[model samples]
Target: MTLSRDKAIIGAMEILSELIIIALLSIAGGVIAAMLPFAFPPAVISLFLLLLLLFLGIIKEDGLSSSSSFFLKYMAMFFVPSGVEIIEYADLLSSSWFHIILISAISMLITFFAAAKAVEITERLMQRRKAA
Candidate 1:
């Protein structure tokens, strides 16, 4: 059997509305984080809240498809600031390239292992839930 993908035809208003909703949620997340004494990154909290909203069907994927696509398409552009920072630190980075590479590779491996284990655990739990 052949699989077909459904392409969502998104309009400008839909993109705008979705962006507004996301912005409001992010602002709310930031406010909540600020009110707490703990050190929590507002952006991560907002993203987690967004994921929860999507999972709960409070925010439909279609509603944010256009905006998400727009952001994803220009995701590389988001790294410009980081690129500039790296350039500014070129002297330090060049001197410690070996150490940087080693740490990066180690961190990457750790992250990969963590993500794989998480997925495996989640799948096992899902299977158990289904079996029950």
Candidate 2:
């Protein structure tokens, strides 16, 4: 089904409203983190705020539907901070290139084996269940 112009406008408004509320809540969480002595990463703070909202029933699954996809899709927009900081410390990363490469290779191999084992175990279990 196609969304008519009026329906599209309404949908856009609803999405905007959801986004404004989420953004305000996130900002509030950030403010709380700033007030506390211990540092909480923004990601953790936002997650905690989301959990609280979910538990309090202020926001439910519907509120986090396709509308939330906009924020999620653009989340990489916030990655500039990480990129800048990493670039600033590029020398340190360069110094550990060999170690990083070794760790990556080992991790890749381990992940491949674990995934293969998981698939085999799951298929066997499913087959047994089907037989029963």
Q: Which candidate gets the maximum lDDT versus the true structure?
A: 1
Q: Which ten residues in a row have the lowest lDDT in candidate 1?
A: 1-10
The C-alpha RMSD in Å for every predicted model, in order, reads: 8.0, 5.6
TM-score for each candidate, following the candidate numbering: 0.68, 0.60
Model 2 stretches with alpha carbons more than 4 Å out: 1-3, 71-88, 101-132
Clashing pairs in 2: none
lDDT of 2 by residue, 34-92 (tens): 98899887657877888888899988868778656766889888888888788777898
Give each model's whole-structure lDDT: 0.87, 0.85
